[model samples]
Target: MKLRRDGESVYVRPMKLDDAEALYEMRTRNQDFFQTYEPIRQKLVMTLEDYRDRISDDIQHWRDQTGFTFGVFLQETNEFVGRVSLSNIVYGAWKNCTIGYFMDQAHNGKGYTTEAVSLAVDFALTDGQLHRVQAAVMPWNQASVRVVEKVGFRFEGLSKWYLQINGNWEDHNIYAITQEDWNK
Candidate 1:
């Protein structure tokens, strides 16, 4: 869909096969930082070939209207900083999807993640024709909760053991914004 967003110092666009190496490095470098909030990676270090294959699969998913993943990069240097995704799409009567994102530990609290997510929500509601976009965050993950709240996702209470994160079933605080909410 060629979705892109340029912030004051960074930009967000779809992930490409050529981004395999940078993505790999970003994941590896942030392993410790992300481990607390993310599901446990099957591998400690993902090989470049494996990442390339994964990116290929992601491209196919994007083409098939199943999901979208975007890479966040520095505007001038093009340094890979993070990623955001809109997944679990369902059409028909639902027309909904879930959003998730992570940024480089060094880049936290800089507002880049908020900008990227805002752009994604706009694209999903307008261009992708989605009626709703949702996100869930671990109760302890204040940073993520702030991101969603900053983007105007309303609190929708908690889901017990909502997702398996860091190898354990964890409760999540669910939040969402509908197209109606966005239009207002």
Candidate 2:
């Protein structure tokens, strides 16, 4: 789905093989800025072939009902801004998943992250048929914390050493919005 904010248009669409180059460019440009908060990349250099394979895997994941990764893009220029994903999906008794996202540093503080996340949450709860969507952010990454908060995710406390970020075990603040929460 596409969302509009301010005067710019943004879209949340499934990742495609054709998007490899733009995705690579965005990631390479923001590598340094993202290292602190994101997981370390195993490879120092990524080829278009690698991205194609990755996108292919993403497609399989989507078909298998394991996860969905959406690319956020600028509708006017078709620039890849970032990605938001709903991973670790569980069904039956536990209908839930985790949401993760990152944006180009150049696009920070522009509400695009929040809009992308909001769209993901809606997809998860409605089309995806999930009960809860959760996100975890490093305490120091105030921008990400704000994005989740803006999307109505309530703070659910911290998880000590919850995730390995940039080779270090980092504490994370957990936030979530349930189907019931959305209904209200």
Candidate 2 lDDT, 1-184, residue by residue in tens: 2322222467788899998988888888988998888777788788878888988988998899899899998777878899989999999998989999999999988888988888888888888889999899999988888899988999999999999999999999999999988888
lDDT of 1: 0.89
TM-score of 1: 0.95
At residue 33, what lDDT does model 2 achieve?
91
Q: Candidate 1 on 1-184: residue-level lDDT in tens?
A: 5478777777878899999999888888888988988888777777889889988987998899899888888887999988889999999999999999989898999998998898888889988889999999998988888899999999999999999998999999999999988999
- Reference-based TM-score of each model: 0.95, 0.93
- Between which residue pairs do clashes occur in model 2? none
- The list of candidate 2 runs beyond 4 A from truth reads 1-8
Give the winner by TM-score.
1
